[model samples]
Target: GAGVSQSPSNKVTEKGKDVELRCDPISGHTALYWYRQRLGQGLEFLIYFQGNSAPDKSGLPSDRFSAERTGESVSTLTIQRTQQEDSAVYLCASSPHGSLTDTQYFGPGTRLTVL
Candidate 1:
């Protein structure tokens, strides 16, 4: 079976530009997540989607950051008006279910650079 995957493994953009990062989770997985890791920092949760339930977006940093998922499949994270502080590796993960104890399989992050 396939694991989580992200596209455009590296992205370079200027400040004030908009970027969209894509992710594909394991088939049939009921839960998907988006995270961001700043240089030398731990991962920061950005969003979570589970089945048909409303997504948990509390971890999104600001209005500039948003994400969407279609029926537990592909997900996309959009960063508007990119900023230097937004430079980081964007990670995606998936679990069999949206449970606190479920193991999450991670995708190689899409490294974003904001100049």
Candidate 2:
């Protein structure tokens, strides 16, 4: 796909397990962000990164949740010891640059289910 894309639109995992989801942003976009939406809830920020700098992890629910960005390219979000409460849609978005929120484009999202 030419736009941002995500793998395994749905995932099911047992509690205490770890899961890794992938994202591919638009070509040449340098800014990437991760967010999650609990069932019937608003989007909660998780992490955002500009190029190779350490991402802003303030929005991460816990140390169990972490992400990394490589250059201005791909990213991965890993959830360790996943819990039922962690079940949600993991969305990846990208913009042209990191100076500001410049119309972030989102993928279909990966639905992580912690049973």
Candidate 2 residue-wise lDDT, 30-74, digit = tens? 889899999899999999988777778899999998887777888
Q: Write the per-residue lDDT of candidate 1 for residues 17-51, one digit (tens) a residue.
A: 99999999998889999999999999999999999
Against the hidden true structure, what lDDT does model 1 obtain?
0.95
Among all candidates shown, the one with the greatest lDDT: 1
Off by over 4 Å in 1: none
How displaced is residue 86 in candidate 1, in Å? Answer: 0.1
TM-score of each: 0.97, 0.94
Clashes in model 2: which pairs? none
- Per-residue lDDT value at 1 in model 2: 45
Provide the lDDT at 60 for model 2: 93
Least lDDT summed over 10 consecutive residues: which range in candidate 1?
Answer: 66-75
